[model samples]
Target: MSDIEIIKAKRAGFCFGVKRAVNITFKAAKKGKGVFTLGPLIHNPQVIEKLCKEGVCPTENTEDRNIQTLIIRTHGIPLELYQTFLKKDFKVIDATCPFVKKAQQYAKLLCDEGYQVIILGDEKHPEVKSLMSYAGKDAIILDSNQELQKIKNKKRVGVVVQTTQPTNLLQEFIGKLVSRVSELKVFNTICNSTALRLKETKEIARRVDLMIVAGGKNSANTTQLATLCNASSVKTYHIETSSEIKKEWIKDVARVGITAGASTPEWIISEIESRIRDIGGNGDNGYPHESGRN
Candidate 1:
């Protein structure tokens, strides 16, 4: 009998927003050629490759006059960049996630209300950059662990969080802001899907002998999942594809838990699971259990 048991997260694959963006891209591809996304539709390389095969490609700039249909990525683009695209002759298909769109709206509203806007997330991230555009020139980007002295002199502060940020960060950031600013307003822009995935992944990490997190390295949500797994004190491997799985990692492991990011596809997760089983001898494999979907 095989010693390894495999457990899978029920909600381990593509989240609603990602699924929507990908569907829209494929449908656009079928309609004609010269389809391009402002950036990657989603972070997963495999999915992007498939989209390319279907004639939909990703472009970083709008300078390419040949682009017939420009689809906005799931992360959305900066306000000025979006406006520039609208004026061009190319058809613009906005596939920005609804949750992200809400965050942008909130950022603009906060600025109009005369509060200092603070966005909680990585300053370099595409989504945060897009949020900053709506928040105006003076808006500040704050990391959860960073000092709040920048906003100390301001009487009023408004906050918006990245859609994939952990809930604890928001709670903690607000706790600190309450005392420093006389009036504080917050828009909880974090996605519900993100919260559920992190919660489920943490629980599984605690129970398993080893954790395997599958998704694109550049994907923020995927990286967060891997980080959470490591913090749980279980041996963890963050891999983009099944080929990354090594035989020795599972040789002696008794229980393996598998989870994926919002950008991951179901097929990739299945391949990873299959690889683990094959390496562990596939004979009398420990029964697999499924947690509820995200």
Candidate 2:
């Protein structure tokens, strides 16, 4: 064994949606006005700290009329909350990801078309909740296939998903749903960026001795990446920063693959790669060189 090697996913880190949200938030922060987000913009503490330095803060309650500017996060908020901000006459800067917007739009359309909209994702997730608002009170949130048995009104069913949900889980949910429904329409609202990252991570995990999945601890997409890597039955570690990587975890490993969540920045990924190289003698593990690897 020569050293650790990183097999980074081509589509990993700051997808178009996340990048747009971050850029909008940073630009608003630069205005140096009283700007507040409904929640942390993107879940990365480092990025949130940087925003805080620029006068962007997060508030849990939009009911407080003192705030001048209310910025929606990437995951978005329920429609009712957005309406509340409008009623309060706050300057609303919508930084919601376009992909997330599509999901919400699909949910609303399904409801308008008289189908019972079913969201395949965590019920508590802000994105799913936001979709529910558009779907009306009749919308159902399904987190797992087991919950499919409880669904009623199988004649007209429409399905959408949280942007960060695993593709396999979404597909499985859809598969189980079709069996129970006479009419099923699926929008496939899972973000393309997330699907691509998951596919790449699985492929890399299969060929590496160990894998490092880096992102914010609370980020749903990041957690999903770690879950996918672990499902490959490889030695996988999920860490937010380079400091969290343990030398013992990869001490006996030859090739190490590294991947980051969609919310992660390139600098964070580079930092982890540098730390891994410091532990091993070299970075490629003496494997045959492939053009444009990593």
Mark the regions of model 2 whose C-alpha exceeds 4 Å error after superposition: 1-4, 63-66, 246-253, 282-294
| TM-scores, each model vs. reference | 0.89, 0.85
Model 2 residue 177 CA deviation in Å: 3.5
Q: Each candidate's root-mean-square deviation in Å? A: 4.8, 4.5
**How many residue pairs collide in each prediction?**
2, 0
> How many residue pairs clash in model 1?
2
Task: For residues 1-294, write the lDDT of model 2, one tens digit per residue.
Answer: 234556777776888978888888888877758888887888788778778888887888877766888899888888988887787767899988988999999999999999988888888888888999999677899899999866788899988888877788987888778878999989988877877888889999999988899899988788898998889999888888898976677665668888888889888888888888876533334435344533
- How many residue-pair clashes does candidate 2 contain? 0
| lDDT of the structure predicted as candidate 1 | 0.88
At residue 113, what lDDT does model 2 achieve? 96
User: lDDT at 273 for candidate 2?
Assistant: 82
lDDT of each: 0.88, 0.83
